[model samples]
Target: MGTIDFDGLAAALAVHGLIPRGGIDFAKGETAPPGPSGASARAVLLVGHAGSSIWPHFQAWRATQPAGLADPLDAWSRQVIGAVAVRFGARAVSPSDQPWLPFQAWAMRAEGLRPSPLGLLMHPVWGLWHAFRGALLFDNALERPRNPDSLHHPCDACIGKPCLKACPVAAHAGGGFDYPACLGHVRSPSGSACASGGCLDRRACPVGTEYRYEPAQQAFHMAAFASPSIASAPTSGG
Candidate 1:
């Protein structure tokens, strides 16, 4: 089998529009929690980037000039992620893996890895505005990095925890988010403003403030909330 040069892989992803930031770890001999498919050959953790144009093609699709508006970013995201997986020579797993929630809980308890104020691994450069498109699990073992640094958690020092405070319905309190409540609000008639204003709580985060999503981009995601399948997707922790 040919050896995989992870650095080269990262560079290729960057060339293909992925942010291509952060560490890659080998999972060959490690004990992974049981799940749908077996453990991945390696686990790549991508650090979020500010103003990444990874999905710009989708953004353009949303701007139908004649009709004045179109929205297809989610479909575009899936296609982009699938292409990346094929390029990496690995099986692609959806971002939502129900069995992985236990692992996320474990990571939070053992590693001080709290979900970002936006309910993700808060990135210093992207804050809570970024996402993991998909994970590529190779069949062959690859060399992994040592001593990967833990990313800075901006919520650690914030006094007001603006993210938690910004939610109009207090959806992010008591250690768990009320998904239904949040979604209900987003789909309600009163939620039209959110479709235009973006996520109030996510925008409230001070870290990586410059990386905030454009109104159109936010609207695309907000519309996704109305999709039952996407909204109820199982969480996959990084």
Candidate 2:
């Protein structure tokens, strides 16, 4: 029942490499699924990370675990974000929920971002190297203006469209993402390159070159990506 300090929350999250992507007033919006109907919702803030900002923290946390957890990153994020939400007086929701949250739509609205040809949200600076970790819902509104569209989209300007061509199986082909084909290829021996370094298609993006995740970080994500149980885990962008 006190004023929420958005800046303080953002700084605290950054210590764990989680950054506030954006937030929007949802007081008048439809209820998010799995959320108790008629609940007093107010605003929703999106969380994300860039590059290997989260790598060190994640690995350090992983060192304490017994091991063999199907998706350690997802495990770690949920635990941490859930606790943070309590302190901030908000509700924490993840994309991997049994009844998934519409994180994609929320992210697009929050950040004024659009999906790239690869079917992942694009950032003018982070390209495909960033991802939504989760969202925080508050019972009070916060002022945050939507970001403006860039004069030129990174994918639109690239005549070569390297991402589409880089995939061995054309998983992101024909203007739509082929999830099954992508999963199949990642599970094959031929997918070793991608499995080891990260998605070949994602790395091929020319924008945000400086923001690319280190090979080690990318490998960790790739490992999770290739896992069937972790496949549905919520992470957009990288």
Best lDDT among the predictions, by candidate number: 2
TM-score of 2: 0.90
TM-score versus the correct structure, for each prediction:
0.73, 0.90
* Per-residue accuracy of model 2 over 1-238 as CA lDDT, tens digit each: 5677878899879889999877777646567533222366677888879878898998899999986976688788898888888878878887777666778888777777778888888887888778988888777667655555333457777899888988999988778878888888888999889888888888898988898888888878777777766545444655
lDDT of each: 0.57, 0.78
Which 10 successive residues of model 1 have the least lDDT summed?
A: 101-110
The list of candidate 2 runs beyond 4 A from truth reads: 27-29, 33-38, 144-146, 149-152, 230-235
Judge candidate 1 against the unseen true structure and give its global Cα lDDT, from 0 to 1. 0.57
CA lDDT of 24 in candidate 1?
44
Give the clashing residue pairs of candidate 2, or none: none
Prediction 2 global C-alpha lDDT: 0.78
